[model samples]
Target chain A: MSELVKVVVDAMGGDYAPQEPVKAAVEAVTERKDIQVILTGPEDEVHAQLAKYPDYPKDRIQVVPATEVIQTAEPPVMAIQKKKDSSLVVGLKMVKRQEADAFVSCGSTGAILVGGQVLVGRLKGVERPPLAPLIPTEKGVSLLIDCGATVDARSSHLVQFAKMGSIYMENVVGIKNPKVAIVNIGAEEEKGNALVKETFPLLKACPGINFIGSIEARDIPSGYADVVVCEAFVGNVILKLYEGLAGTLMKKIKGGLMSSFRSKLGALLIKPALKKTLKSFDVTEHGGAPLLGLKGLVVKCHGSARSIEIKNGIFQCVQFKQQRINEKIGEHILEMADTSKE
Target chain B: MSELVKVVVDAMGGDYAPQEPVKAAVEAVTERKDIQVILTGPEDEVHAQLAKYPDYPKDRIQVVPATEVIQTAEPPVMAIQKKKDSSLVVGLKMVKRQEADAFVSCGSTGAILVGGQVLVGRLKGVERPPLAPLIPTEKGVSLLIDCGATVDARSSHLVQFAKMGSIYMENVVGIKNPKVAIVNIGAEEEKGNALVKETFPLLKACPGINFIGSIEARDIPSGYADVVVCEAFVGNVILKLYEGLAGTLMKKIKGGLMSSFRSKLGALLIKPALKKTLKSFDVTEHGGAPLLGLKGLVVKCHGSARSIEIKNGIFQCVQFKQQRINEKIGEHILEMADTSKE
Candidate 1:
């Protein structure tokens, strides 16, 4: 191998950090011989956890020293500026200076989003960077772009999002000609507000991407389309609602199953199958959202992410790098921008 | 008793209609002595369904003459205009002409929304009418205003929605000072787009309404606020997401429970308690959404509504009429408009 794909992970970030990230990093390095993981945090805490995973290649994993941790309550930009020695800031710097192929953080979302933009920077011709999260559907998973960034997005930005998102889904997710759609108030072409009405015709006109017409929120869980595109405001609503409702319903069902003696007996028999089925809907099984249209790959793991979530997020970076998703996105975005100019 | 509240029912609407609406009409009139229902549809179908319920008071449930039915596929404005003698059209006209206290239809949502505005007209000083649906939550049900109508809403329109929804929740839902929150991208007061930013201060300044700060979609099911307000586009997404996610989760959980022998036994004992708990989350129990800020009280039931949904919808009309929701909304709107002018 010419060189190992070095990945920097903020081990001190998230709710179950130091433990979860350390465990996940150990697992990831064991599976992929071509990958090197730099677990950035205080060295002693990391070493203590490493002892638990004696089988993981000690040579493949290295500790990068960092002293600070960014709390959720701290101001995003200020924390990034002040906490230069923080795990999140140090990890981002590695990606910026080209010491690592990608940066993974299960830390504060705001700080990650800010650092991704201010530090790593955007790819050329990209107006706004979108947070594209892969949501599980009956048919598999679909990409929801601009989940929490660029709230007041324009039609041009949406057109760019559709193109960039299509590239990633096809290259990494293995979908051919991923069907792209603009999330709207209705299914009809002329049914939405000014942003949707203006963007509908543009999305339809874009020749390279498979622009499916409008998609209503109700059709999303049914996997009506592969790539659902919208401004951050609408996208955020869809993503959060999916999370909240899923969590609420799952809790209700679990409570109902344990309510009585017969149900308790029934639960014992089907516990294995129920566990398997519920695992499929678990959001943690899916990796962190990728901040698309960036110069280099950046993924924002959930703030409360455990080891499995962190490993999945880092694994996502490996695929992103292997497929050269960034180069293709940059090329595609440039082509669209040039054509529009002409 | 001051004359019984007469509710016009579209007997030919919905999937199981003529039977479902007729059945619900009978049940509603039987249960509540203070209400009379006029069944509007082809006489034969209505009489055939009525024949099954001989115990129903014939005088309280009379059939109105209507020949045509508005199919769900028909264009809303075209159907309303062409199908003059259609059950939906005739039923709405009764409400407009003051011959009925309210109109309940499990028919075309588009037709109802269009007809409610075009035929019944909006209240004076009302910029746009909103479809306010009562969504069941952990605390109770909340009124989600502008679920389908008024796409490109302005600050003034949102302010009016807050006033109308607050009045409805207070008088009809029986919540004092019903917390009103403008749906936004973030919870902070400084967050949201141009429309939300402009409307926030206006809502806060209004005298009678209890204007709470922003509420994200995740906060909705947790019952963080009682009255949620948004423009039609956002509100439609919230409503559909709630329905889609709830339905999908229920299906997944049921599938999981039936997958094994032990779980099947467990499911049986807890089935009763589970049923009771799930029933509380069902949107049908809450009935139809009221088209707020309209000159007359208009309620739009789901297209696939069954007997229970129809019955609940009609019962909701009793509360609407009793609380005089329309009059209160009209008065609030006029006062706000007058004050804003000065």
Candidate 2:
């Protein structure tokens, strides 16, 4: 491994693309001495964006040239297969070759998920790789595993997700034996469908994690669980609903606040406090979803990621590396197997 | 068939039973001339509660004796089977025997769902009876079908839910050719789990209903579709999240508003207009969930339902009767079969 932690970023990927990624890389490298960033994109555009930041430290960030770009609308697996010279492909190749400690992208989720599994590969003993994202809750942010990957997922995959997610939360995120709960329609153990019902008992029996009983989707936003578990379909629904409903309610609240003259004045006064409180409930600023149970670290940020989110995504790789999260996860999986044998 | 649209209510059910349901019965009789209520519970207890309302039209609200009560913790199917004289069972029997046009309960959802199907029975050719609830949306209240009834549901069942929900929305909720959408993780036709993938084409070809394609959970609060279709698991998660997150946000906003004196003054000015807007998003104040596709209507209100929700639930049955909703639904199902055959 390199002395300085190296993170490969898809500079041509998000909606803001080269500009945001370029700015984030400069900020990340400038802010930390033990980290380096490799920007993968067309040489000219990436260099032009980097040149705009004249005062930024130039030595810590590198630019790698790629010939093609993956458009958002293109088929994900096909795009990854066809555009081997694209920024996403080049970045993944860097991680696979161990030239980069981790890869960060604000590209197509489908492409990232497909390429991560096909190229970087899964960890030994892992049946499937899960995409785990951190969601802002009332207490703090909670990690939701299998949010988009592994649709029609079986109970065994859910068991692995719990173990991998628990490891990440404990070692990297630094939560102490994080409280894990399976998402069910009701809190009762017997209340879920076939998948949840079968997984509930296995999760309870999981070793080395704080396993709480089943939790309903309603209780999620209240910070009731440190790690919320579900298959891809249920997890995706919860994630999207959390985003959509929170957004609509915030808009409605703002509109309500602006309806009258007195309310507008009040809105002005409470603006700072409201922003602070809401920031605690907004997790997108924290970082991106990590494709866990993989051989190497891979983080997928939102397609619309800006500088803060992109920078945060790059920074999380330092923790993953310094904490040796992947090695610990491999050890945990073996430990779980040994425990099950007993 | 009766001169008035008669609804039997379980007076001993709910968290505030014998009080809220009793008061709601009185209110319903006073509000509408074409409706009557039958209170089924312990004769003396129900009568003493009704005596508190001295000026109520006593003749329009009748009392029927029931000796037992089904607690929320009892096994639903077994409770409906064993509790022959319990308020829930007796109330359902009244509808089964054609003495009442419908039955309303604020009791255990399992018991209500069990008794609604086992006792009141399904309309001819109805495969599954679904619990459909009106959720407050930005545009208006939208009906979410099978919100908790049919867990582990099949694709064919989803197709039927779409048809049934569309009919109810058109006739009862007064939406014309209501747009039906199956709940999905993504809007793309090919993107979803096994159930939605199978149900999409079936709903698209369904007769006598307007079928839109897939809808993401995030788009739900915007009222993108009049009838949101899903099995109980997805629907329940959506409903509970909608309630829990919305409640949490409102509390957080109120806390923010009350943080300072200036905001407090602003709160007073925006109170009425805010109240009006928020009320449009509060579906509980409107009514309860209806166990549709039953021979006779059976509505399950919230356990904490008070006078207003109970009164509205009783009132909604009048429209179910006058519009001949069940008959219309039966016709629609037959038409779908004929279309499939062709």
Candidate 3:
């Protein structure tokens, strides 16, 4: 018989707080009987929210009281160091102490990033643990690695990012032998800045994953590559820009539809279809980005995440553990490093 | 009497080549008699394209014979050096020799960037010439500086980029005291990597423009700043991503609208309003990006530029000339530098 996968969720982390996280926890446990959840927050608040979900099995979910809360604006390192009893830190501690199989939070990105490393720690030989998100594209979605997880990265670090990204796409995403590409200004190898210039050749030579040549920012949405590797700075810019543009475009489209009566009628008729199409592009439909290379899984949902996203993030951990992604990643990277040395 | 602004159009550059450039030249001359265009390309081809436009004033529009074409793939420095008679080089040389006030091209961006600095020369105390493009935003448009022309930039170079961006926005775009922000992962000054961290305080204390704190990429489309400054690599990623996302989103919207009969009907009804709204986000409606800090203006239109875009780029030169933008930029940056040193 298989053991239950214990998932630790930060109930006080996101904008919606205990309501959404507690609801998502109930939804998760109800959906999968094999899953057990430990909700960390103010015990009374969590219990009250959980009581709202009457159908959730009473014994399957438990609450771990965390007395403190970290504001998203607070400095990350200081918060992580100071707030030991906060939901974010306590959840991460569950992963660190092996009380839970995985940890999920919608807290401050900086706090999650810092706590993931300081608490969950890194796998042996892992240089950096990148936050890799599955970004929707024309051909479906691609993995964007190192999105502000590690900045001012060297060529070797980027090569590792490509490998870890490839592992996530291949094993977890179920994309067989994902094609990896380094982001650059132009497709030509000589077109990038210092970091990309130095990393291009090394990526081209890195075996195991199918390493495509350079990918321009223009090519990213075309689904030109399954795994797009970049330094945290570049990746962060791309991610933020992607979110910003999608939102503005959506808002404009709605405004356009409301400009006239005829268009308003049309908008009503097509609302469902348009909503569905736009939903495909929404990153929230997918789970939070996992801070890969950590000893135990540390997933960060969006700060504004609600129940659906929290639920998805929880399920993502189940899949990660089921596939034994960390073991595969550790092995794949170590083998690549050895071959490169040889 | 004000002298006419002579713009040397690379008649042989771009996908449509002499057809678009020549048509644009005729349109420019007809629209404003004070504008003159010198078309540089093969003598016969330029004349043949010009012949199609019989209404173009012979005095306002003239053809300068050039024998060669620099393929987009040709090495930039080598092409600018060896292909002296090529349309791009010949046109740049015309600017260098003061035969034209500006050079407009839809040719290889690399060649134009290289030739502009080498031939047109930099204004005194300009550390690096950045290609600044006015990108459409929610409020209006924001200037994105250092879009891949100069990379591996230092904090000093980024400060210069911010100053030049501010000058262009104020003197050319007609924004008074443009709000300038350095693009970073998060809004905090301490959030960015090495370059941004170093540049943040310097820009804050640098007097001239209205210096806002760091702007995340998500806030860019919301028109958070008039001038967005970054190192060339980060700036290039933001610019390219902006273009790519807009294109991809537009395509997806069209596809979604055509997915069903209801959506198709709605699309037909909303076509006019939607078209008008989307047109505002189109970068081509705005003029080409000027390689700022050069003696003579060099504007690079999109490589796939059509007649309308080519025409707008040609007229953009007239405003730059009338406003004496380069002098304003030189004075603004030099003044800021002096204050910072003190």
Candidate 4:
């Protein structure tokens, strides 16, 4: 077997907390011999959940007790500063100390982002670390870079996001020469606000990426580009709106299907195929948002993530480590710097 | 009947052009007695379309000759400057000349916005003219302000949008003291970028409006707010993405329903109920986006609008005139200016 990729899992984070994390850790270890999980939380709480999975690999799973829990509503900076013994902080610290190859958490996005930047630190030559997530599209999936982290970003930061996003999609997602597109109000070159206008040419002129021109928000769901780039505020709105609209539409669709006896019967006939189609679009089927450009890998899952999502997040980290994404990013940034210098 | 609300129709605008616009003009006159429409395009072309509805109310509709047309892809500033005899320009000039009460078009959004500002002009003390569209939601419709007109908006501009949105919703849409919310990444006050952060406190402090705190983009489709305010870029993305996603999902659903024989049969049985339910969520059912704060009303129909939507757009203009929306806006801005001075 290959060398193990040790991933630290935050057991005290997310809506389901220790139970889902513990279950996912067990699932991860059982599915692969080349991966190990370090579970961090209150010892007894984690142990009680772990007890239910008696057949889990003993050597591959270990517990790291941390008594404190960081609440999602607490200010991220303050929580990271005050709660050093919290599961989130401990997991991040483990990555910083080189005790783990990656850290996975379904914690407060703010806390994880702050800890990822302040503790694990950014890779050399990175302007700002971005939270990039794989969003399902009609064709397959596209990586939306800078969804939340680095909200007030400049054009230079956006160009870097495009480059890094292309790298992640091409290597991690296995798409060759992945197309990178900047999210804009119009497909026209002269349209958009100051930030997008400034970033457009920079991205167009950037080297070593398939930089497709501006993409309207309407084309995003059709999967027109492999990598979608934008500053964090616009990206965050797009991500949340996408999720929100999908949920609303699903509810409305269900309500429509149940309105009459004949329709309900029709719903029953279409349920299996429709369910499968909807499940494919479910974001949790994909993994967590990775804080790209960090020296060590850190992944932030949804706060409401269940065991399946948690397990997928763990597997995502394994892939990241296996592909040496951070090292590749480091080398790419250096090449960019050298080109700029010359 | 009440005083006639004279609306100029851009016969050379939109995907369907004279056919849809002329049909809508004839339909509007037949549907109501208190409205008149002036069709502006190549005189012969407008007359040719009008000939089909010869039995219709000839007295309520008139033809205004214009020899030019503005393409959607043309630059807004240059188009407005150069296309002097264009249908859009001729229509706007009528409003500016007080020969028309309102201008309705399924034309270039950029050109209409620019023309509305440069021709019909802004009401005194009005900071910016917002393009407020009534988007269908679970409960009813909510006005999404500044979807395209002003992209890089200041806090003051946002506050103005909020106030104008409230006035229009209450007076035009018949919602009493409509709940207003600013779109943000998080529900927390301090969670946004510089513009939203500055606008939050100002919105909170503003009197005579129902000011709700921050609303995440996820909560928007659930009908949580009657008036949703954002700068243009974010709002445009939200609007387009909503439309695009709905279309994509509908296509996917139709595909799913036809994937199997059982599903195909079910689709036939449920087709009527499903169509009715889905039609309620159709945005074009609501009407065109109104260029609020313009001295004379300017309604922008979707570029792909059919006769029904254009007819709805004409009716929307009638309602605005009946409600005296522009007058109310003028008084509200005066009150705001007085309060700020105090």
Which candidate number has the best TM-score?
4
Q: Which candidate model has the greater DockQ, 1 or 4?
A: 4
Tens digits of per-residue lDDT for model 1, A1-342 = 545877898889888888988998998898888788999898889888889976878898989989999987677899999999999888888888888989888888778888889988899999999999998776778899988878779999999999988998999899999999989977888688899999999999997999989998888887788899998888888888787777766566567667777666665766786687778877667999999987777888887888788888888998899898999998888899889889
How does model 4 score on DockQ? 0.75
Please list the residue runs of candidate 4 whose C-alpha ends up more than 4 Å from where it truly belongs after superposition.
none
Q: Give the Å error, residue A303, model 4.
A: 0.5
lDDT of 4 by residue, B1-342 (tens): 589999999999999998999999999999999999999999999999999976888998999999999999999999999999999999999999999999999999999999999989999999899999998888889999989999999999999999999999998899998999999988899899999999999999999889998888888889999999999999999899888888777777788888889888888878877887788888888889999998899999999999999999999999999999899999999899999999
User: How many steric clashes between backbone atoms does each model show?
Assistant: 6, 0, 0, 0
List the pairs of residues colliding in candidate 1. A263-B266, A266-B262, A266-B263, A266-B266, A269-B262, A270-B263
The local distance difference test score of each candidate is: 0.86, 0.88, 0.89, 0.92
Candidate that scores best on DockQ:
3
- Model 3 DockQ (Cα-based): 0.80
lDDT of 2 by residue, A229-292 (tens): 8999989989888888877777777787777786677667667667766766665787999998
- Interface RMSD for all numbered candidates: 2.1, 2.1, 1.0, 1.1
Q: What's the best-to-worst order under lDDT?
A: 4, 3, 2, 1
Lowest lDDT sum, 10 consecutive residues, model 2 chain A, at: A274-283
lDDT of 2 by residue, B1-342 (tens): 446999999999899999999999999999888899999999999999998989977789999999999998888998988889999999999999999999999999999999998998988778898999999777777899989998989988888899899889999999998999999987788888998899899888777779889889889888899999998998998998888887777677677778778667766766775676676677687799999999899999998899899999998899999999999888877777676678
> Once superposed on the true structure, which residue ranges of model 3 sit more than 4 Å away at CA?
none
RMSD of 4: 1.0
Q: Which is the winner by DockQ between candidate 2 and candidate 3?
A: 3
Model 2 TM-score is 0.96
Off-target runs (Cα >4 Å) in candidate 2 are: A1-3, B1-3, B260-265
Quick one: ranking by TM-score, best first? 4, 3, 2, 1
